[model samples]
Target: MLISDSQKKILSLLADGEFHSGAELAEVLGVSRSAVWKQLNGLESLGVPHAAVSGKGYRLSRPIELLDGAKILDHLDEQHRAKISSLEIHDQIDSTNTYLSSLARQNAPSGSVCLAERQTAGKGRRGRQWISPYGSNILLSILWRFQHGPAAISALSLAIGVAVIRALRRLGIDKAGLKWPNDIYSEGKKLGGILIEVAGENEGPCYAVTGLGLNLFLPEEEAGAIDQPWTDLGRIAGGRPIGRNQLAGELIDQLLKVLTGFEQTGLAAYLDEWREYDCLCGESASVFIGAQQFDGTLEGIDAQGFLLMRDADDRLRAFASGEVSFRRAFP
Candidate 1:
């Protein structure tokens, strides 16, 4: 899934959703018409859609707001920009999380961010394959080094969820909510998810790679692969497109704020804020653990970020992690 420099150049030219004649593209890219044709033929593998008309030349089905590292940095405020150690953008990668995880092994500094336009092997929580089309959505990961161990950051993902909701709100998407441990929802449909991977000691220094996958504009082919109901930010925003650079800047800013706050005050500082967007706060939830199952009424999350539920026997139960689903119980 490697996108050559020539292909990237051609994509940038076609990104406006307007037709470009083969001769015109060839001249602009300083390549032969055959070379441009070859690159155009390879766009399908990258999940980019285009139309080739006899007289009108080639036109993309939709215009894309591609990521620009410079624009992202420019959008950040001085304080937030100072916190970021490094930010890298890729045309294609296996996974942003995987890339940052490897860097963490080399003592990668905190506040490093990685973004990818296309992920051939993108991953989600619980071993689900993340569907990412080139120039279609947000696929990013941030690396952070913590003085405390992995156990101390148990509430990290929950805090990250809050950051995501806040970032969406900044873009006028105020209806987004958090679904328990790690998913973002809009109008009861899945919008995005968070995946955190930690490496290092249990009681000392640790590194975490926090990954986020958000749907922006999913085509029919990609949407068909998802097993659950899903919604994209574009549709929720009345089909108005938001630039990827602006969205990325907002996410990094909010994420850094929450991470710094968590580093200082633990999860207690975010409990009340998280409750405001808690999607399953009062819904009946069922958890499946191997051959066992437990059903209870959601009482919101505890201060430690664990899910709190009132069981059938009137006892409160807290779960660290499991496969959970919400259901309505008949009165």
Candidate 2:
């Protein structure tokens, strides 16, 4: 069930483990006592049962076992973890990236994460619609600010792909592979995608919002909305529902570790690691760059992260940016 900002506020207040009188909550939230009662009852209906004492008011019967922001913070070392200034979770949103971008404009600190259980209008690279069902997929965005130029920021997506693949491997999804700039694949099917947006001057300090949408378990009814073959972590992990909050925390930690290095050396520093997990390399593929299309065998990415290909005439060509589709070529 979706929880509103007001409900979240009430939950936060009750999270202290002390009985907060209904009048006190109403005063704090600027609502009537009756309204508070209604909200509390709504929460109870949503499986968050609470106890109401005649004089003391309402208290959660049990602490919310949801993701622990403090615990995640405690697990990280001082340096990398300290980058995060805030972590906000939403029950529903249009898009995590969109929400984070709005916060970035207001100068929200870097490493701020805005996550949602579902996104009504999630999107991927080139404005492709992302499938986001409630409680079944991860829809999150991390706000990062860099002092580098836009040219340097271009490789950030690729760098983040490496981080996602590493995190998935940690969860025992070993066959995960990255498809070009930002798609994560398993068994030749897409498992997740990364979308990045930047705001600021071309060369000055820039804020990049990196959004991640990962399928944990796809609802059967909603699975048809996905255009291509796709798989979820639940299937790969033997029907275990990965704790979304835990996965988010781990992904953020690893991403910060990687992005710090990337900001210094660009994609060149991670070339070998990227190649070790390359999914399209050594396969025949089609590169769509504007109106011109080329069919070639995937060689490998160059030092600067450009896709390298060998054409039918055995001629070599390098593509920097385009839509690439992989397939097995018939001899």
Best by lDDT: 1
Worst 10 residues of 1 by lDDT: 322-331
Write down the TM-score of every candidate.
0.96, 0.78
Q: Which candidate achieves the best TM-score against the true structure?
A: 1
* Superposition-based RMSD of candidate 1 using all C-alpha atoms, in angstroms: 2.0
lDDT at 331 for candidate 1? Answer: 25
Model 1 lDDT tens row, 1-331: 6998888888899999999999999999999989888898899888897899998899888998789998988767789889899999999999999999999999899999999999988999788999978999999899999988998898999989999998999988887899988999876688999999998998999988999999888887878889888889888899777888899899988888877667778888878889999987888889776767889999988888888889889999888887778885322
**Which residues of candidate 1, in runs, are more than 4 Å off?**
328-331
Residue pairs in candidate 1 whose N, alpha carbon or C atoms collide under 3 angstroms:
none
lDDT of each: 0.88, 0.79
